[model samples]
Target: MQNASHRIRVYQASDCPELTRLDVSKLGRAYHKIPKIISTKFDSIEARLGIFFLKKYRLNALLSNLTFDIDYHCKNAQIFSTPYGSIGFDINRKFLLSILHTYYGLSKEGNTVSLDLTQSVTKTEDRLKIKLGQELLQLTMVKEVLNETLELKNDYTSIIHQWPYSVRFWLEGYDEYCFSILLDAHHVDLLLATSRVDSESDEPKAKNLSSEQIEHMFNNMPLTLTGRLVSINLTVAQLLNIGPGDIIPVSLNEPLPVFIENEQIFSSVVAEERGRLYLSEFNDKTPEMKYE
Candidate 1:
């Protein structure tokens, strides 16, 4: 005989008045807040799952009279013995049959199909396993279903595999026909891998100067030159007695020295044209006399 000590009485929607009136509107505004109200008395299991499936896949999955039971296991070499929960739902059999019919081109007459459940392991060996189940095996196609359900080509397998925890989904209101997957610590790391933002360096890089910028810098530069060949040493009385039309004699043969920015760079001969002084016969000659 089977052990009755392990069996626990589970309640249905008809047995509870609060479960019958549950609706999706009772959930809070944020999608992340639904996890807190999942096991509350105000909302039914089916209602919470319906909202979750709808928001995640945008599919109108019909779930009815959902219920879950906690199962405790002993420590084993292959599986972790932590206490975990399993939830069952009466799925719309026709909707599930239609998906298999459209994709794999399988007949819609059968009520069940085989599925593979892969679990990520976090032991020192870094190993994992894939198990087979009858009805629950169809969950392997969940990524494909999500893509078809949303009418897009997005690959959602990577997103679904990031959940590092235990979650079980049962269909046809039967515990024997269920799909289950476990995500260990390694799987959680994959989900949080992209959370950190990379920091940028504060130092500026060298920029190449454009032609316009070089032209602007050259146009703003000032150029100065002084044309003086000799300085006449005059006493204070000779400078004060000087008047207009006074001719101070000097040697015209001496070349005028041109100082650019107070530096003697070139020497030029002095020339007169139309009573205006001009520099002519320029030569690269350093002046021997220094300017004070």
Candidate 2:
């Protein structure tokens, strides 16, 4: 009797591009400043509306002391679109309610105000969600820092595909209301690009160094040089049959391939110096090179 063959599928944390540890570290550093930037922006708003005017008009509902944190996972995160890609996040419903209650002068001291999770959001609450989302996106410089052409997503959906990175943001005193944001690798790239540009601008202007000095500086920098001796292609059966100390015959092609950081640059021939082996006779083509 013949047996049926089946392939097994692998599951991963997300469908998006995988972030390396270095990428995660850079993103954490970049996002750490968000809360302070937002806080300053909020303070400016209050300053614009003088203390006397705010006291007299009773218009002091401005958001403050908000914090941004990193979240590795997310649930029920709302999806929004940007020029580069989509962003997913969900604010804590209770926190939203608290903000609304505070603005409307409602008592949130006890069970007097509690939201029913099963109940659908009212029109007022929906509007507030949209408004606040837009405001926060702007304050976080999602547009101003990345791209001015970027627009806040008006309509949002909780059903979204998993993204690689997430951030939890909330009002400092309202820890229960913390919201988590989900973003993919593209957004992180844009952020890092902006960050790089800013850092370059802030760096002291370069001094006038001669060509020789510049050459010397670069020559001192360490770089890895790689050489490929040969490559072998094998079928699964051939690979499975291999055993320890198995000698696989490989022919050396003239002017073997050379690489810089794993990228093929040129090819060179193997030569012997006084006491050491070296590469010489550089060329663009080799005898084993196949054209298709």
> Against the true structure, whose lDDT is highest?
2
Model 2 residue 35 CA deviation (Å) reads: 9.9
Compute the lDDT of residue 168 as modeled in candidate 2: 57
The runs of at least 3 residues in candidate 1 whose Cα sits more than 4 Å from the true structure, single-residue gaps closed, are 1-207, 210-222, 241-247, 273-275, 287-292
On a 0 to 1 TM-score scale, where does candidate 2 land against the true structure? 0.47
Local accuracy of candidate 1 as per-residue lDDT tens digits, 94-133: 3333333334435336645543223232241122111112
lDDT of 2 by residue, 103-200 (tens): 67574345366656667787877766666666655544464445455675753544555555565554434447555556666776676666667667
Best by TM-score: 2
All candidates: TM-score: 0.22, 0.47
Query: Alpha carbon lDDT of residue 7, candidate 2?
Result: 97
Global lDDT scores for all candidate models: 0.39, 0.61
Q: Model 2 lDDT vs. the true structure?
A: 0.61
